[model samples]
Target: MASLHAFANPARFLKIARPLTGWLFWTGAALIAFGCWAGLTQTPPDYLQGDSVRILYIHVPTAWLGMGGWSGIALSSIAYLVWRHPLANVAARAIAVPGAMFAALCLMTGSIWGRPTWGTWWQWDGRLTSMLLLFFVYLGYIGLARADREQGGDGRIPALFGVAGSVLLPIIRYSVVWWNTLHQGESIGLASSTIDGSMLWPLGFTLAGFSLFFAAVVLMRMRDMLARARNEARLRRMARA
Candidate 1:
């Protein structure tokens, strides 16, 4: 796409990303604080689930970012493989750590939510198990990318792996539907949700906040990678001189 190429130049990308980074990070932090406060203190408890339902404010966003992170990797991987765009590869590598962290957070928060709602600390349910698999997939991508870099290999292998890892995304999404599981069926929809309005608004802030924060992190990582590359190139030049 024309838009992707426009920012493909690392210099151009950094110019734009640098300004947005601080804004995104601070705004996201503010929203997270406010959203958590509101979800914990302002909203009424669910008649059935009570205050434990508050964790959804955090749990849902982590799960979303966990899956969303892989989606970014797959897309970036496609761009890198198809166009040989270097920044696309940078993006895929940058997303790995945060994606993995979010996936781990999702599992942790899900367990906390489960203990109260499901009457257990853990379950081998479809959604939970698939999400755990996604976490490991993130780990694999991170390690694979590092190994590829250290060996002086072209990034295609990791890009290919990124593409393949996407197979798990759809499986994770539909796991609850395909199986009768402890995890509840999807309650949110495009136009409506089973959740009441008061209990739901904080989720909006948390999701938006976390997404912004994730973008900031990826950009920071990309910039760091670019700086390292530049430094290495300079060192190589000095050695030859």
Candidate 2:
């Protein structure tokens, strides 16, 4: 908590974020490349999924980030609303675009994976539907944030929405369990994974790579936003002078 507030000063945050940004971006890109290479070339095709199993590398990560991204937003929003952490709103807004993107990618990749495995390009399965709704939620948050800024309102409006949107998170997670859906139940868990070791290793790499990439992107966006806000403040001071 003290550490989080320490970086609340935009200047201090930038001090750390600037150097770290390039390292994270480059490292994440390298890991992603390596992960994809390993996933494609090193891993054997699943006896059940054939070559299509390769999509799991991309699909699983996107899905995790899609949900995890919102988790970030929710936490940021909470920080903004409850603690009034200065950069929290910027962080939440920064997270929206990439989060939505991952959500959309999840849908696209899921459809591709489904077409081969489930014999269809799309389905209204519980998991799929809830995920689609999550994508919509991301869009809504992005739109609301935009509108709030245009109206020159306090950041609280979108911050509230970010908190409210989190309600969808649990629903998406449990959709498969609650309904009879074509989407598979959770294969990975904190303690154990149902996935075979041969295939699971590459997935680990891809997941780590994409998550790092996502964090790098979010940091970049936050830095950009803070700079813009600082510029706007300077301009306002100039106008007053």
Candidate 3:
């Protein structure tokens, strides 16, 4: 709690974020480039799925980040509501755009992948429907956050919505297991994974790259928000003087 409070100061946070952002962004970009090359060129095609398997490289990482982004929002929202941390709301706002983008990407990629595998472009399966709902939740949070800023309302409304929307995460996660869906069950897991090492290596690289990229983007957004806040404060002081 004390450590978190220390970071609540935008200046202190910026000191750490500024240096880390370039490092993270470049590292992530390099890894993503390598992963894409490896996945598309070096790795052998799946015997059954053939070239279509290459899409997995892009699809899986986006799907994971889509969920991860919302989780970040929910956690930050909790911090804002419970501790009244100003940075928490800023972090939540920063996460929203990337989160929503990845969610939409996941849906589009999934649809493209589906056309090759499922013989159709769409399915109302449990996993797909729940993920779609998650996208909607992201949209709702973004809208609410914007409204709160414009109206000068405390961010509690969006924070509460963030917390509530978390219920969809679990449903999205377990949908494959709970229902007989076109989407396959977990191919990767902590205890063991069904994916071949050849394929998994590129996938691992992509996941790492995407995760770092997400962090870099969120930090950049936070810095911009903090800068705007500082400018607003300075303008208010000038008005008073």
Candidate 4:
């Protein structure tokens, strides 16, 4: 807890973040490029789905990160509300845009994949509906955060909303099982995965790449926000003088 609080100092955080950001961004980009190549060229076409199965390379990672992003927001919000850590709110605010983008990507890619396999563009299934709701929640958080900043309001309302919105995460995860949705059940599991090792390696690489990409984006946004706050403080001090 003490160590976590130490990062609340923007100066201290920037020192570490500055050097790490470039490394993460380039490495993630390289990995994602390699993963995409391997997924598209190296892997054998699925016996059942054929070439379309390659879409999983993109779709699965985005879906996982989309959910993971909101989870991050919820956890950060908890820290902000409970311990009053300054960085927690910044982290939540930074995560919203990329998280929302990934969720939107998931929906788009899912729709594309669905047309060939499911023979339809969409279904009002539990999984799809819940995922859509999650995207909206991300938008809501972004808007509320913006409004709070504009009004110079305390962060508690959005923090509470962040916590409350977490209820949808579990539902999104379990929707395929809880209801007979058009969506399929879990392919990957804690105990075992249905995916063969042949395809799994590239999938793992892409997931890691995307996750690193997300981290890089969040750090960059945090740095920008910190700089803006510092500049605003300076302006206020000058005005008082």
| Model 3: per-residue Cα lDDT at residue 136 | 94
Native-vs-model 3 lDDT?
A: 0.93
Tens digits of per-residue lDDT for model 4, 80-166: 999887788998999999999999999999999999999998999999999999999999999999999899977878898999999
Of the candidates numbered 2 and 3, which has the greater lDDT value?
3
Model 3 error, position 175 (Å):
0.3
Question: What C-alpha lDDT, on a 0 to 100 scale, does residue 34 get in candidate 1?
Answer: 90
- Tens-place lDDT digits, model 2, residues 33-151: 99999999999998998999999999999999999999999999999999898699999999999999999999999999899899999988889999999999999999999999989
Residue range 168-225, candidate 1, lDDT tens digits: 9999888888988889988788899999998999999999999989999998999999
Expressed as tens digits, the lDDT of each residue in 1-241 for candidate 3 is 7888898887899999999999999999999999999999999888898899999999999999999999999999999999999999999999999999999999999999899888999889999999999999999999999999999998999999999999999999999999999899999888888988877789988999998999999999999999998999999999999
Cα lDDT computed for each candidate against the true fold = 0.93, 0.93, 0.93, 0.92
Which is better, 3 or 4, measured by lDDT?
3
Instruction: Provide the TM-score for each candidate, comma-separated.
Output: 0.98, 0.98, 0.98, 0.98
Runs in model 2 lying further than 4 Å from the true structure: none
Checking candidate 2 for backbone clashes, the offending pairs are: none
Off by over 4 Å in 1: none
C-alpha lDDT of residue 117 in model 2: 94
